[model samples]
Target chain A: MFTQFFYTLKAYKVPVSLTEWLAMLQAMEKGFAGNNLLSFYYLARSLLVKSENFYDQYDLAFREFFTGLEVPEELFDELLKWLSEETLKRHRDSVDLSSLPQHDWETLKKMFEDKLKEQKERHNGGANWIGTGGTSPYGHSGVHPGGIRVGGESNNLSAVKIATARKFRQYRKDVTLDVRQMKVAMKKLRHLRRSGNLLELDIDESIDQTCRNAGEIELVYHPERKNDVKMLLLMDAGGSMLPYAQMVNRLFSAANSVNHFKKFRYYYFHNCIYDHLNAGMEYGERVSTAQLLKNLNSSYKVVIVGDASMAPYELFMENGIIDYYDRNETAGIVWLERIANHFRNVVWLNPNPPRYWQHPTVSAIANLFPMYQLSLEGLESAMVELTRKAH
Target chain B: MQNFEQYCGTGDYIASRALQNDVNVAIALGRPLLIKGEPGTGKTLLASSISEGLETDLLVWTIKSTTKAQDGLYIYDTVQRLNDARFGDHDISDIKHYIKHGKLGQAFTSPKRVVLLIDEIDKADIEFPNDLLTELDEMKFYIPETAETVSARHRPVIIITSNAEKELPDAFLRRCVFHYIQFPDAAFMNDIVKVHFPNLEEKIMKEAVEAFFSLRELDNLRKKPSTSELIDWIKVLVASGTRPKDIGRELPFLGALLKNEQDYHQVANGETDTRSIRRPSFLR
Candidate 1:
């Protein structure tokens, strides 16, 4: 069994040596690994793998070698069935809110609460279930008047608040997003300051000083160039944002690499800025909008990234924050206004096409803030607007 | 037969049984143990501990973003050779004279088996690991300029660490044993604290530990306190002769725990009780 596994790793180009194989066999003779699959996995990796780079390969080989012993195929089939049913149920639960008469915030809230009380089992394609694709004032993906989206993609941003446990891939700062167009766009935020430790040789200073000192040929030193602009980026993560992941990731990576920002701080939110802004999904750090506003000075430039396509109520509904049902007297629009007021230079970067700018929710947001398409031209114009002096 | 717990003398370092087993397997297979963890989880210390336990010399090769794979194997000094040839220097004809054995070459040529630690493999370029694949697999590398292949005299116990700053190529990750060092829980943290502060009063230690965990558990903190940071905070508290209950009162020392401005303001402004903050409607 060990030999076959060893052969498997070798086939994967794990670079296990004959002597190393002998050593592993010797360790096994001493009863190193018991019947535990995890223990065996650890044992195999330690002996056969030499570099951290091959760990993923070792994992694949180990899983391949130990197939049928771990996860059962029947279990997978059951899981798939459960997932499909859940999806179908969610789809069916979505009520056509457009067909129903539009209700005021209070009435809709009251109806939503009553529906929540009566909802014993998951309902779909119904008038009342707080599930997706239905007009029920509480779930996502279906047209609903004054509805709160529970879990699913947002088409009409109708939800006062969104709630889901879905995880999002973190925007990797280390990955170089070196698209030439993005780089060109990033130049707008460039505010370089040469300060700190001496990094680059000051050629002009050196020559001037040398000439002044009777050609002593002494070299002068200047500090490294640093970006002095303070950029505060609030991004939309998850749901409809999933389709625009690559574009957002590119933007994120480019923004980080620009290295011209004296201070670059990023916080993630969904759809609109609400009461609390999440530091990151993985980090799970929740910062209150009040706290964030207080922390950042008015000098900081704020960039809001989102499609801005949601129900108009989402912007105006009290306690209508979509991710969670937090009942605040002030709505999301109030929070947006407060943030805009606090920051002297604020711009909204919409990844959604300009054709979608006519979206009720999107247009409403564009009116309140300077909205720019997330493109080379849009970024350039946004930066020009931001850099424009009081005159 | 000794485990990592034993290897990390005086400090337990939260060495899980799985990690110990993987190290043992690495020893048995003559393969490198690749450890991935968040920053400040004692990834680098593991290599030193293993070397100390085995009583072997440790050869460390710290990787930078600019570091090339050629930096690990060997460097052929063509310029130096050319200069020597022009100056009619002796041994200009000998290619060996121009060759400076790099970290890997030195480890391979060592008479005794050494512990080779390749720290922060993710810092290097995407091609860095792939470039070393042939040498790592075969335990030998050929110098194109020298037209000579140099092989390992003794198989060194290799340990590679990554913070996962960059995604390593699938081909490179497949060649090694992988272990993710998880964040220590409150109980596991107690053991680590005891190792660091043996004479700390139980009351003070418990309070400090509770406070540490509370701070770490806080969902509002961007940078969570790691094991080492917790240890440092405790050390400061002990040095000041502060009682366990007073740990929270010393607001000046709060910098040790909460590193960020927002975090400091949040805690200092009496927002430590996160439960008061509303959760999502469904979650509530």
Candidate 2:
């Protein structure tokens, strides 16, 4: 009988507390058996169930839970009368609270959009027409992104608008590039072109680096435009960095704009990319940065971008990007020069406030490489640093 | 509770009010209440506890790999008496007395409510549950040897626990009330821990609880940490005067909650943390 009651309460969304049951039994004056069947129901409700919809549910539950069993009506009335509001509310809410959880955008879209889409897709044979939204297949409208937009295309528009855009385009066919948008990070790569970064060649840097030498920095130079081109990008994935995730993401888009990533191929490092660059969650195989570098000569270009700031040793210590297992990854400078020696082309874009770039570690790290650091604000001014070289 | 509680911690078993109510209905109606749960969740404890609380004698008839019904009730006394009086008075009547007071006989004769804990009824081969139906339904067990069926004036409380290793025959299930036991949630575990270990630092206690539950939810968790293991975890913490830094070292020993070795290794290697996934506002 009680087994039935358990499923009974569960279905009704009434939580039957083990703690409450003990209390209820203690409060009861009679054995559960001798009590009228009605009283038993009331007693169980008072003890185990407290929800708003108990009466109807009890009617349903008692029929199922108490089926094939005969009990008196008096006990049932007592069960109904003594129910507390919480018990009733719980029962009523439990019916509705059938656990429809608040959904994230992905989850919400996943749940409804698929069903809606399937409805549309299955409506396949119907005539593709409006008012047909109620009857037709591909949905009434707005199903496709700007597909035959009611207001027309936002970018690729009608001839009238295209004409207008073409006219406007003539004057401002004027365009600019921001060096800071260079986010074409070799995300989750195992090894860079094995030798060095190829994003750009700082002929000025090679000269400066060679300044350390009497005449030449012994430039291990080979600038095979095919082989020497390289890039390294590190993106902060978690923590407070979440807000700028979209911005950081967009920076990557611009980075691709500067150079189509597929054309140049590259390496990835994180705040502490260290050796984990190989085993990053995103990596399937080691990207062989060294092998990538051997294929190129000094003509390769290299660029780096990041906010470049962190908690103490977040760049170097345990719990750093190096991953806890690898505390001894070569310094970012060591990795930088390995690539710099291969390709003279390199630029460091800092998303950090320009004011912060003067921070000691920032300077120490920036000075380590022959890098031209540009803040995101001076994006236009930073262009042509690359295009100028090619020209 | 029957000694079964020693095997199952409170966390693995929640005394179901519904089950208890059903047991009462069984007692009032002279029927049996059968329970089903995962093997480790302490179905045995429920039968045992109900028996104890009601001041009834708990006769645990644990179903075994090859158990037969006759094995539980009335083992013939002929062998014992014949051996003791070997080369002497071996009366046939004495054989009848020997055929008495096995699981069924003892249950029949006990003046108080005899709680027949048919533990793991699902374990025995098919014929056993089938055999018991007559005894369970009629409150009388037949022994062809005695030629007179044994009956109980006051129906002994019958409680059966099944692990559901295999599907049960419907004809057998229809006779008893059934309740299922699922693993308890954290709030339930917290109550259990409070009951199990009333004195411990609030912080370590809560952290220990969180750590164990997280260990269940994350870390490639395979099996949930049951109540008994939770207590053992708390016991380990209390003995060790837990330090925040030490959580890493000590958490792997809690391998009982995680069935897979990889989960243990991950926790050991600092890949898993009991910490919540909060969006910290600094990575940008």
Candidate 3:
């Protein structure tokens, strides 16, 4: 019955699995959700959605499946309150349903449909119909203990108003990455090697030696593995990159906070890397591009963050540096090419969306280095690219 | 089949209806409840609440960055065995003597049902959750050294909390029931505060909660004051003999709330208009 709901969740890219759907069905079959739509909503959500990151998508899917059902917020809240109270009372008193009139599943479903139609036609005054606060066997706040409470009220909106709220929209991964998420992405760039002094005991080797020595104990120690990856971050600062300053700052801080790297260095450039890069934003210690290329070996993974948007001449022509005071002997593209050639792994993170990459400068820079969007998924892929072996 | 007890909110821990429903569903289904939330939203406290409410034993396993999944199952004390062999003081031949059961193993071996809380599972390596999938699903772990399978006498109610530090693998997540503990709204926060400080005057509680929410609403604050923080702040306010009317105005003992220096300064410097604190449209 819920297969279509499963498909709807998939359509919304919620990543719900058949296993989860079956689990929710099993819970429902066991009467875990009882006859409450609110309880059912929580049950399905808890069972089917694995991560809060996909919660907004799940909410959308749920709303789509239960569209045209908007229960008044106050009424829904009251129903939830009443249902919880009823469940608590049931638990306390061990409510027995054998005394109540019972009907088979098909009869109950048909009765529920007929009562719903009657309630819609009558509007108000139906004490024995599928409406609230009545002895009708089909709706909540009624005295029928054994009857199935219809999931939603007709004429009124459905219980999906909760789903339509979309409270988890902030958690969507497609949104801009937060500093903590950025740090998590940066944490994946690990190239561990046993470079430190021997400290950790090699248990297998020690056990082997003990056995060979006939009951004598032997200890073996080896150097602990350490992260040997060195990262060189070159970011575009000022001018066109102004809009993405906060995002770029988050990336910079995330990288700076991750202390696992063997060596970490950052420099800023206005439009592109020119004769030298600023050690800080616009004004700071100037490290000549030649010096950076000479000092940092080819083994260093380089990440360049920028919008990659600029006048075509600024990238292609000599002395086309954005800062008029700074005269560059070589074109911006040539400097980028030098860095790309020098580094074994290099990736450019464009703050602009992939669609904007069609611009002349962005595409030109894309040709020089593998460019990725600055979103969480993009950063993750960029991190993957940074760890990939050079072809 | 054994009857699974439902976990209503305990006197001390005020769980919302949705949270209570999710907890009961997870308990009934016998699946590990994976909880994600902002720090200090009572994720860890829920495990204790469940154990207390169900009248069962509680076992906690705290995860650190260096924690391995194997450490939670059973730690084979091979080094102890080796040391015993050298000293000739203990039974070195029997591998069972060297086997030390971890939190999970203890929970599995317990005579009665227990609540097992894996606190901050995300602090461990990303593969940590995946490594324990089989054990969590089957409720058993086989120790090759001892040649014995330790299966659960009763499937312990497992609650795993994540700070969302790292994204867990899909395979691991698929095996568990998940819930995100939304931060409590003002009304819910009032109940939570009353649970901690029952004797607090209604006026002071109202003003303190209002002040706390206003502080949380301030933009650019590094760390927003959570429920626990609000409780502490109210405690300080009551203890300091602060007046109810002076609660939001002076924000007495602000240190109990805002831990970050910048957040404290932002609230103290009158940079934020506390009086005009806009409540979010959706309270629930």
Candidate 4:
């Protein structure tokens, strides 16, 4: 009776040995797990499986093997929520909706207005009303040819627009990096143009020089090739960037770990690159834009990490900054333009997905400096672009 | 095991029906209960609570990012053994003297079944969970130094907690009984507060919970006050002899609630300077 269960676990790569199977069988004989299916499920898993990560996989296998066993509603609810968002997003991208009749800008606007007035109470899985699931022309977690998302999380990219006030966590600065991988990728940013003092021996060059000197064995010391790349990383550490904290931290640590730079300095900004830059949270020295322009020369490769998602007013309108006293002389764009003029190469690493680059605030920043995703691949390409002229 | 009923029944730790059910399922299966939740959601407390309830000795293993799987097993002090063999007055060739059992090892070796708390499993590297796969499943591990196998006399009731800082691998997740502790709702939170502050006035408790929920609803604020923060904030409120209605005037003391500088500025500045705060009516 338990053979099929034992085989099922093994098939799922659970690494259940014969001895363990026998032990479980003996335990079954002793009536430890009892007759309860849920109890049996736990007993089998505890006896055969280890590690919490595998619990999810074992659950799926158990559900399938048992067939019609009632799982706790909470688990299903969480799984469905996670899957709907992810699966909907993935399928939405691949699923071609171009063939469907496209609604013009005016029609979309009118339809959204109509749905807002009609949507009185909460609705789900229907043809209309802002709710989750179904072929509604509005809401999220549902399939539709094209619609708008309101009050729910985004998954179905078919939505013409989204209006959400989701809060994100602050980008942590303490995330450690895989130094080896970071070193390999960061080597691309090396500007080996100049030679410095002979600090370390170059075995290959030394050997060649000795052979050229007719095996005289006298050492020939040459100036060491240095990584002359200078980088100025200005990170947006507040508000919108809160969600991408982990990814941003990885990028920050990656940049910090790489030793292939002549000068590497970093600063913290809120949303947009404004006149004042914060050095630290407490007793943070507010460096003026003029001081920054004067101190860092054009050789510095400026890389910025931010979601760049903020109200347009914060970027364009005067005195529109969210935090601190908004006594800036000009708009944020003006300060950004000045920084761009001073720096030869700049790349903005947005922690938010590339699909969100179309957001007005993000697009506005993208127009100023070349923007890239904050993934390892994204960082690699950005480095390549930064080193295009130098290499 | 019979005492588990009474232990859970009278325990200080308020077990939601869902939580209790999950624990029961884990016990039935003899599997480790993998409890993942946000920080301050009582992931650590559950272990001690269960141990207290079960009348079992609780063995805790707090894991760090650098913590290896081998650290949970018996650690062989080969260097010490070598030194002892070379320089000691007596022949100390027995490897048992050099072998120190870790929390997991000690739990497995205990005469009575123990409650093992593996706190912050996600803090360790990816390989740590996978390394424990065989040992945890079989309830046994080999000591190469002693050339002997150490098997559990009684299977421990293990409670593993993760903050979900890093994603656990699929294989590692499949083996355990999983439970996710959600942030307690308003009514549930009231009960949770009463657990900590029993003698506090009902009106003050109600007002404090209301204020906490309102602060949580502020989407702009970073690091909103969690359950622990709310309790701490209420503790200060009751201790200072400040009435619930007078909380509006005591807005200056918001350090307990808001941790972020930006959040502090948003709440504080919004209260004092209305011109600077471009917020909704409720926030103003």
Q: TM-score of chain B, per candidate?
A: 0.87, 0.80, 0.94, 0.91
For each candidate in turn, the TM-score is 0.51, 0.41, 0.87, 0.51
CA lDDT of every candidate: 0.68, 0.49, 0.81, 0.67
lDDT of 4 by residue, A1-391 (tens): 5577667766765556676577567555545444334445545655565433344445545644543212234434433442344233223333323233445446865876676666555556555565566555555555443344443444333111210111101211112233333444566677665487766545566557656866544344667556789988888888667777655665666678776678888888888767788886322787887798899889899898888888898889777777665566678888888887788888888877689888898898899988887765677678888876632
DockQ-based CAPRI category assigned to the predicted complex of candidate 2: incorrect
Tens digit of per-residue lDDT, candidate 2, span B151-249: 876678787777654345555655554455546667877776776677766676677777776665552333456667777767876776777445643
- Winning model by TM-score: 3
* Candidate ordering by DockQ (highest first): 3, 1, 4, 2
Q: Deviation in angstroms for A23 in model 4?
A: 17
Q: Write the per-residue lDDT of candidate 1 for residues A1-391, one digit (tens) a residue.
A: 3567678888866677776677666655555654233454556556655444455556556555533212234533432322234443433223322246665557766776676567665555555666655555555454543345444434343111110111101111122233434654555565558889997768778768767877555668999766678988889895888887777877787777766578888989877777788888433778888988898998788888899887777788886766554556688888988987888889999987699899888988898889998875677678877775543
Candidate 2: TM-score of chain A is: 0.35
What is the DockQ score, from 0 to 1, of model 2?
0.01
Q: What is the lDDT of candidate 2?
A: 0.49
Winning candidate number (lDDT): 3
How many steric clashes between backbone atoms does each model show?
42, 62, 5, 17
lDDT per residue for candidate 3 within B141-207, as digits (tens), equals 9999989999999999999999887889999888888999999888889889888988889999998
- Please tell me the TM-score of chain A for candidate 4: 0.50
Model 1 whole-model lDDT (C-alpha atoms): 0.68
What DockQ score does model 1 reach against the true complex? 0.24
lDDT of 4 by residue, B8-59 (tens): 4224678765466567556655667888766788889898888887788899
